[model samples]
Target: MARITAGVGSSHVPLLGVAADTGKDADSYFGPIFEGYEWTRAWEREEKPDVVILVYNDHASAFDMKIIPTFAIGCGERYMPADEGWGPRAVPPVLGHPDLAWHIAQSLILDEFDMTIINEMEVDHGLTVPLTMMFGKPEAWPAKVIPLAVNVVTYPPPSGNRCWALGEAIARAVASFPEDLNVQIWGTGGMSHQLQSPRAGLINREWDNRFIDSLIGEGQEARQISHIEYLRETGTEGIEMVMWLVMRGALGARTRALHRHYHVPCSNTAIGHLVLLPDNGEQPGTDDDRALATT
Candidate 1:
């Protein structure tokens, strides 16, 4: 049976991609940002999953005012990188797991979380930047992916509780799949920075760290946070943090945080990345964990 091996939460800012692509990651301005992911990169070698369920928001790349599905799942065999304003990032096309995506879509609908199923769509930086951050610019991604796009760009996005519950439903769907697959749910975007209006430069590290603390905690307190609170305190654009709750909820009630990194001033955002391993007697995804194993 398929089980959720881990959850990854990260901030997905477009400029970060540009910085990495331009080979300026070690520059003073970007060094802190790139350094934050070093732990994750080290941890990934030992904890790689068969597939990643990437959760991100569409930045007006695929869906315009014409349509906005509160939650959408990509069930296609492949997805091309989208050109958001400037141009598409120089990255490999994303390979999809259509079989698993279809199964999750069907399961979600039956579980009462109606999702907009997409067989075709261009993926924007919101999705690609996180990939670039975690996996780097590989000739091909090390693992297949299932894109789960959430509507955080527009008002009336899924509530925190709703996103959390949907994640729980996805966990159930993954477990019920007959195939033996290692699955990882990755929630991307937000660490308290806004990129629109006069409030574009806002960065609330205290609040962001508190949210991160709650996420690492073995409790649902973070899921109980309201959208209004996220908007009012974390900045309007900072409200994207709701997507992280999805990753948190999918990992069950207990988790062992394997690695965490947080840094400021990634263009107009505060970058955050976290790696978590489920604590149900499952082995940690690292050689160090194996060496120190108590059980």
Candidate 2:
């Protein structure tokens, strides 16, 4: 059976990709940021997943003001890198696991989590940047991908708790698949930084570190944290951290931290990364099980 082997949380900063592509990541200013992901690069080579269920927000690259789905799942055969103002990064196009993606979408809808099924779309920095950070400049991504996009661009996006719940459902969906495959779910974007409004470069290193601690040691408590609090404490854009909760929830209540990396001022953002594995050989709760029961 297909099993979710791990969960990863990371920040997807466009400038980080720019630095890496231009070879500035090795320079003094950006070296530390790239170095933060060094462990992850090595880890990936060791624990290669057959597929990555990437959870990220499209920064107006795929979905603009015209159409926005709170939850969109990519069921396409292939996805091209998007050109976000600057041309697209010279990365290999993403190969999607259409079969698994379609399965998850069908299961999610049946699980009562409305998901917008996308057949064709260009992936932006939100998705590609993290891939670059982990895999570096490769001929092609080593694993197949299932792009799961959540709408953080639109105000009042899905609640943190709701995202967490969705993760549980996704875990069940992945487990039901009969294919023999190792899967990893990644939640990308945010530590603490705002890239809009007058506070374009706001960051809170203290809060970012504290949040990481809470995530590693007190994940259940992290779910109760409201989005308003994230905005107030971290920054408006800091709300993106909620997506990490999705990755956490999918791994069940028990997990061991395999590795963690944190660094500040990755351009205007604070970069954070975590690699976690389920500690107990237990099946994650299902919709009927309801880790966070709906009343």
Candidate 3:
């Protein structure tokens, strides 16, 4: 049966995608930010999973105020990069795992979670940026991706608890798959940083680190964090951090933190990344395991 071997959480700042696409990632300002993912790139090369369930928000590219689905799963065959105003980034189109995606959608619906099934939709930076962070500028993404777009852009987004429960349901769905495939669930967006007025350009390093610590440890604290707390402490957009809990919950009750990286002021956002392996009694590697494991 298909199984989730690892979980990854990352912040999908749009500027990061521009920097990479324009070859500015090697420049001084963005170089350090891109460097943080070097370890992850190498690690992923060795632990290549066949399928990745990417959780991200649409950023008004695919969905807007007209129609917004709180939870949508893509069961399409391919997804082109969306043109967010300027133009679509020069990136490879995303190939979807329709079989797995449809299966997951069915399982979640049967499990009492209402999910919108999308047959075709253009993907924005919210989905592509994390792929760039992990796989770099490849002609084609190494893994087949299943886009799971969550509605965190609009008001009254799903609660952290709700997202966490969705993750558990996803794990159950993946386990029931008959295919013997390696699967990875990824949650993207936010550490903290708001774009709106009054408290715009906010980056709470203290709270961000504390949240990362909670996730790396028992994860109970992160799981219990409320929506109001995120807005009050981390900024309005900081609510995006709740998505990370989905990745954490899918890793089961316990997980071994393989690697973690956190950086601040990246395009006015706190860029955070984590690589976690399910705790099944085996020890993790020591060499380069904590290379970029800064909090």
Better of 2 and 3 by TM-score: 3
Error of 3 at 130 (Å): 0.6
Q: For model 3, how does the per-residue alpha-carbon lDDT over 100-192 read when each residue is reduced to its tens digit?
A: 999999999999999999998999999999999999988999999999989888888998889989999999999999999999999999989
Candidate 1 per-residue lDDT, tens place, 1-295, comes to: 9889889999998888989889998899988888788767766666777899999999998899999899999999999999988888889999999989999999999999989999999999889998888887689888889999999888888888999999999999999999999899999989887667888788988899888878775878888888888887788887788899899989888877767777777777788888876677565556546321110
What TM-score against the true fold does each predicted structure earn?
Answer: 0.94, 0.93, 0.96
Better of 1 and 3 by TM-score: 3
**Cα error of candidate 3 at position 200, Å:** 0.6
State the TM-score for model 3. Answer: 0.96
Regions of candidate 2 where Cα sits further than 4 Å from its true position: 281-295
lDDT of 2: 0.87
Report clashes for each candidate as comma-separated counts: 0, 0, 0
**What's the lDDT of the predicted structure labeled candidate 1?**
0.86
Candidate number achieving the greatest lDDT relative to the actual structure: 3
Q: Sort by TM-score, best first: what order?
A: 3, 1, 2
**Each prediction's whole-model lDDT (CA):** 0.86, 0.87, 0.89
Find the 10 residues in a row with the least total lDDT in model 3.
286-295
Q: What CA RMSD would you report for each candidate?
A: 3.0, 6.2, 1.9
